[model samples]
Target: MATIDLTEATFPETVGAEGTVLVDFWASWCGPCRAFAPTFSAVSENHPDITFAKVDTEAEQGLAGAAGIQSIPTLMVFRDGILVFSQPGALPAATLEDLVSQVQALDMDDIRRQIAESEADAEVDAGS
Candidate 1:
């Protein structure tokens, strides 16, 4: 599958709809982002079931800021409409593949349980 070019408008619906999605936060001038593009795209083709999307930070400044993207080439993985991983830096093809495997192996029921517990804790903390 080809990588989807995500704008601020489509970001939510695309990432929220379902399944596993990998988002690359990048800018045109960032060297690391350029270097990582091929690896990301190649992985996209390898996993047709997964959605691969890119957000051009330069164009989506508000979205980048909201996402807390401190550096270029930030990769965020969303599974089951929840963000599972986010980090800044370039990843080699092997690392990307391993990450994909890990993400695919995650038990989303457990992840959801954790999310619910975390949210409950946060609410309790706020009530305190």
Candidate 2:
């Protein structure tokens, strides 16, 4: 599948949907972002089941800011409406592929349990 351009309006629904969604936050002016575009697009073609989307930082400043995008080439991976991985920088094709493998292997139920435990711990600490 070709990478889709995500806007502030479409961002929520797209990422919150079921399955894996890979979002690349980028800007045309950044050299690293330009370098990563081809790799991102190529990987998207290979993973037809995954939704690969791009957010142009310059065009969608509000969305980018809301997403905490401090860098031009930030990659955020979401699975089953939960953010599984997020990082900044241009990733090589091989590394990106490996990341996809890792995300696919994750046990989301365990992840959710951990999140709930952490939230509960935070709440307990706040009550102290």
Candidate 3:
């Protein structure tokens, strides 16, 4: 499996899709981001069940800003369109693999349900 190129156009469909998604937020000019690219690609190949996507901060500033990404090489894991984990930094390959496994082991159904409840609460607040 190869890493999926995530653009602002495809972000909603990709990240918000019903599945396990790993999004790598990066910029081409950042040294750490460049260094982590290959590792991210390799991880994508290694984990066929996980959807790995890359967001170019330079080109997709809106998406990056909305994600509140203040640094390069930020990895965010989402399960069923709900954020499960987020960290800023370049992780070693082994650590990155461990993160994927850890996320996979979590109760994704519960997370998704929680997210739905929060969203509903927000909607009610907005309407009030």
Candidate 4:
């Protein structure tokens, strides 16, 4: 599938969708961002089940700010409408592929259980 152009308007709906979503935060002025574009595009074609979205930091400053994007060429991964991974840097193809593999292998049920436990712990602490 092709990468979707993400803006502040579409950010909520797209990221909140129930599936794995990879968002590339980039700016046209950044040389690394330009270089990583083709790599991201190539990887996108291999994963039809994953939704790849691009947020143009230059054009979508509000969205970038909301996402706390301090650097260009940052990558954010969301699974089942929850953010699972976020980092800064232009990763090589191998690294990107490894990330996809790792994301795909994640046991989301376990993750959700952990989150629930943490929230319950937090509530107990708050009551103390």
lDDT of 3 by residue, 63-95 (tens): 999999998889999877778899999998999
The candidate, 2 or 4, that scores higher on TM-score is 2
Candidate 2 per-residue lDDT over residues 45-124, each given as its tens digit: 99999999999999999999999999879999999999999999999999999999999899999999999999999999
| TM-score for candidate 3 | 0.86
Query: Which model scores highest in lDDT?
Result: 2
Which pairs of residues clash in candidate 4, taking residues 3 or more apart in a chain or in different chains?
Answer: none
Give all TM-scores, in the order shown: 0.96, 0.97, 0.86, 0.95
Name the lDDT value of residue 108 in candidate 3.
76
Ranking by TM-score: 2, 1, 4, 3
**Mind sharing the TM-score for model 1?**
0.96
Clashing pairs in 3: none
Report how far off residue 88 is in candidate 3 (Å): 0.9
| lDDT (tens digit, per residue) of candidate 1 on 1-128 | 99999998999999997799999999999999999999999999999999999999999999999999999899999998999999999999999999999999999999999989999999999999
- Alpha-carbon lDDT, every model: 0.95, 0.96, 0.89, 0.94
lDDT of 3: 0.89
Kindly report which residue pairs in candidate 1 clash with one another.
none
Q: Write the per-residue lDDT of candidate 4 for residues 1-30, one digit (tens) a residue.
A: 999999999999999998889999999899
TM-score of 2: 0.97
- Cα error of candidate 1 at position 2, Å: 0.5
Error of 4 at 126 (Å): 2.3
